[model samples]
Target chain A: MKTLLDLLMLSCKKASELIDKQLLLNLSLKERLMLKIHTRLCEACFEYEKQSKLLDKLLLKHISTSEESQIPIQINIELKQKIIHNINPKK
Target chain B: MLNEMDTNNPATTITSWVKLYSDNLFSWALHKTSDREIAEDLVQDTFLVAVNSFDKFEGKSNPKSWLFAILNNKINDHYRSNFRHQTTNNTISLDEYFDANEHWRPEETPQPWLVESSHILDNPEFTKQFEECMQRLPQHWFSAIHLKYIEERKGVAICQEIGITPTNFWQILHRAKLQLRKCLETHWFKI
Candidate 1:
């Protein structure tokens, strides 16, 4: 059983890599199969994947909030002044 | 969103646009470069280009989108000149997390975050620490995170734009995420 499992299984490290790739892109059929086998067989890799997904969620919220006004980004008056200065028609 | 673009006196309303759009532009630029001064400069340059080509604007398109388009171009150019030339080191440090048999080391395994509320973003301290963790990542990694997460761009396109191959991009994100998870666990989760 160990030998058969080894034949199809990905190590947790490789499985984790595949998990992250799955978050961003579609894995090839073989990779998808292997990741499925490994995660089903190895419980730790499955938990890692869950945590990774959670991290992605948190990161999106973190950045989107920053994108919005959650982070105090002061609009500098000088930035407006400098831009107006540049566009001014120099006689 | 209406630009109020009068071809008659194209330059007149730029001052208003400058005030209206600088914050959004600077915010985006800051996200891209993670530098306040550079974000400021990019905002300044974006307004200059917008003013120069004001007649072309036509006021038909959403002014915010139009200005954002210009700012995005400036950001692309910024990355092209600054980062595209630098070689991306594809060496991913996996041994730190894996043992000889490629199993996760006991200490390096992923533990539960124990997050109770989905509204964790409401916690300013957690979000602040989250930004600190992100700031800890290298510039290229930050750019990768931004493009992948915030922009939701494809992996191949992100790799192409960042001058890294697809596999290299994969490895960078993997390692960068590993660091982030560890940092967050240490700092926020305490698990």
Candidate 2:
């Protein structure tokens, strides 16, 4: 039988993983039980779960949408030429 | 012009890969090193290595993965070669820095102070703070986090690329997150 502390740590890890997943999802049975037991006894992990969810929202907001631009035309041409020449030495 | 290439030529395939992946690879390297010059050199080195070993690439994996594997080895080599000279300048005393008793506990009824995502682009300080927090992480942990999170690679794929077990990968990520949160709390959120 896992100790309460062990169960709490597992719950914390699962809670963090869930933050990146779909919102308002139900926890796994084990996770739900761990949460019920731990949150009833330990206020810190409860607050942590809340804060982790909030942080996930903030992270999604800050994710960069900028698509990577192309390599400069000159370098692309030069590299292409080099590779072509390497493939066919007499090119 | 690359348009003149015969469709079956290996050169064409190589050039296509370069065209497709160079910018992404360069950006990845730049973010990792935080030095544009070094990043460019690393990118060039990656291509050179790929080209020289082109025959070894049996198309078993995607071109991007192959190139990244080469680049990872190059980066590791660069670090190993420079570690001695780099470590001489600023030595941290571990005993003075780490305290087992200084454990962190989350606040009770934590006030939500989430920054809006729209502000990240405009706020240079936030980006700087993020980069600083990233830099404080151990190199392996930092690499694991960047490859997994920023690159958006799945755990199994990242494990394949980095040659680490899934358990080790999770451990690295856990440590990295814990350190980043601690750094952020101390550097940005302390009131």
Best by DockQ: 1
Which residue pairs clash within candidate 1?
none
lDDT of 2 by residue, B94-157 (tens): 2222234321223312233454544543466776786788677766555555455443335676
User: Tens digit of lDDT per residue, candidate 1, span B75-188?
Assistant: 767755554554446566789899998899998887766886568877888877878898898776776666666555566876676666677777777888999998888888
The residue ranges of model 1 lying beyond 4 angstroms of the native Cα positions read A28-30, A41-43, A61-73, A89-91, B1-11, B31-33, B62-65, B76-83, B160-163
Assess candidate 2 and give its TM-score to the true structure. Answer: 0.50
lDDT of 2 at A35: 59
The segments of candidate 2 whose C-alpha lies over 4 angstroms from its true place after superposition are: A1-28, A36-43, A50-66, A69-91, B1-28, B35-38, B46-114, B117-122, B150-153, B160-163
TM agreement with the true structure for every prediction: 0.81, 0.50
**How much lDDT does each candidate structure score?**
0.76, 0.54
Model 1: residue B143 alpha-carbon error in angstroms: 1.3
